[model samples]
Target: TEPLEKLMPIDGYEDMPLVPLDIAVEPLVSSISGIHIYAYSAKERCKNPPADDLTIDESASIMLYSMDSKFGNKSLHVILNEILKSADKNKLEPWLLYLKLFLTALSHLPSTRRQVYRGIKLDLSKEYPVGETIVWPGFSSCTTSINFVQSELFLGSAGPRTIFSITCYLGKYIGNHSYYSSENETVIFPPTQFKVIDCLNQGNGLHIIQLQEIQPCFSHLHAPVFSSISKKPSSKLTFNSVVNHNTKWKQRGVTLTKHHSRGPKPDCLYLPYGVYVDDNQTIYIADHGNNRVMAWKYGATSGQLIAGGNGSGFNGSGCETNQLNKPINVVVDRRRNHVFISDSGNMRVVRWPCENGTNGEVII
Candidate 1:
């Protein structure tokens, strides 16, 4: 019943334009055996669509199809998927526009990498081999829970069943926007390629298959790159909100970073209170948690200890000439090849030589 779990086949319709829902789906009215109750009610039903990349009408187009249940009979998901999974490629002509709109809307939703569940009424383990790649041409109907897939409401525990634990990389969860929010629906848009990790027959007419979604070596349908619909520019390095355009943050690969630890080690950084970037792109960090300053040359993995790595000033033995305590800020006096540190815990500013300084000179 969670029709929002459906996505159309986008293989050959890469060049199709994003027309309105009514005009896009008009070609199928005479041919397909279905009905639409929410035709043109996109604005009314989808008052708060998730993303801003697509227009309201564009977002509503997805919402309409997601909730549209053929006047209380067959769902748009079942109908649209039936055509998408069809072997006849010519049948896709009428659905090109709708497919374009559906794919574009799905492309706007944020991607979550986790395992999603899907249930089939029949055992399909024989078709998939270990280490083999498979492509699901149609939209994948999946839920976040295995219990939901096994429940009596969905594919019941009666006949032969195959449960797929799909590790989807770019899966979209549209359950909140669907008519059935409790289904915990998350879907994989087509033509997503998957590699079978393992397939096991668990006896009693039950089977389990582990699938990992992967980028295929070759293009399946030449899906156009929709860079405009993405939430952010594709970059290897993660960025916070409100990125400064003046900085070269959008560079292809990562530059300098510290994540999730304060370190006594050269590579680890914790609670960095200050940073200074030199003209040569070498970065100096006030590793506040470690009571030391670390300097990293451009593209270097680990940092070189600049000052006060022995211990903190307040650690029973008291401040040593070679030690620092709670250093808050740092600046490089490049003219004299010296580093000035605000040694706050010791209540003084200390100047240390960058090239060769075992102990800092109390300059304050």
Candidate 2:
């Protein structure tokens, strides 16, 4: 009895060291490239005649070698086979192919990930978020012979022969000469043409009026142009008077209430083109004349700076947050504590948080 073994030289040289094989009848298998191979066999058994059939171990070894050579030559074939097996289990073929192509073409660089994430976040935000709106109340014309009940209310004709009244809630026609006659008038009073400038709400439903002569200006002018009518002598008359009228009647011929002039004529009187009132009664005026928004605190007679106070020029946001470029109107959202400004010249709207004024959030 002998153990199964193979013999070969130490190297592929002809005169290399030779080793003896333990099993003499075993075949020497060689690859086509002349590389030597070995086969394992069992020793001959005298009693059982060494079972004539090929052993399972020898067959398995040969099959495994064949398979290893085939797979080693075509490595991609095995990979494809594995992928096919997985696809069969998952029932994914066409979709998997598409995904593979997509992944291949997608960004592979690590640096782009941040930019992509930011772009996606921005796109998602735009899909559902509601942006802010800035509104400013622009002064179109001077309303003399009118009364401002509150900062929000006005009672007077906007123009000659056009009597109207405005409250914070709504506006109504007192009487327009084009539509109503004297007999149709609700109250008996002299028919005088005047514009209501400001209104004061007294205890007895009494309101005062500041009247100035009217001078026409360009129809497109959003701010009151003093130069357009300054040359007219009739426009020089300034009357301060109170018009006591019931909610139902037109009252007249009342004595005027004088208000003492405060401060030495403002270095510059900024005629507010737009106004916004916050919860604290702080008035935000888009002073177009000053090219800035002025803040008049609740009890203060003078206005402080809010936004765009450098005499109307476009520049950086340093100390000029939410600078208005020819601002025309302003609206305040008391609920959100935000101010909306219509930067008409810039053709955009800008917003400012009511709590902070330095940084403006541009909504449009």
Best by lDDT: 1
Query: How close is every model to the real structure, measured as TM-score?
Result: 0.54, 0.26
Which TM-score value belongs to model 2?
0.26
What tens-digit string does per-residue lDDT give for candidate 1 at 1-364?
Answer: 1121223334567876444455467667676544333655654565443444455545666666666456446667777776777666677888787777676767667798988999988888888779977777667768999999989887787789899999998888876554556887787876678888999888888899999999855543455445322232121111112222333444486545545364578887654556677777677777766789889887898889999888887632468878888676788877899999977667678899997689998887
Q: Candidate 1 — which pairs collide?
A: 262-270
RMSD from true fold, candidate 2: 48.1
Q: Cα RMSD to native, each candidate?
A: 20.6, 48.1
Model 2, CA-based lDDT:
0.31
Question: What lDDT is obtained when candidate 1 is compared to the true structure?
Answer: 0.69
lDDT of each: 0.69, 0.31
Give the Å shift of residue 186 in candidate 2.
36
Q: Give the per-residue lDDT digits (tens) of candidate 2, residues 147-202.
A: 22122233222221122232211111112210112211111001112233443333
For candidate 1, the TM-score is 0.54
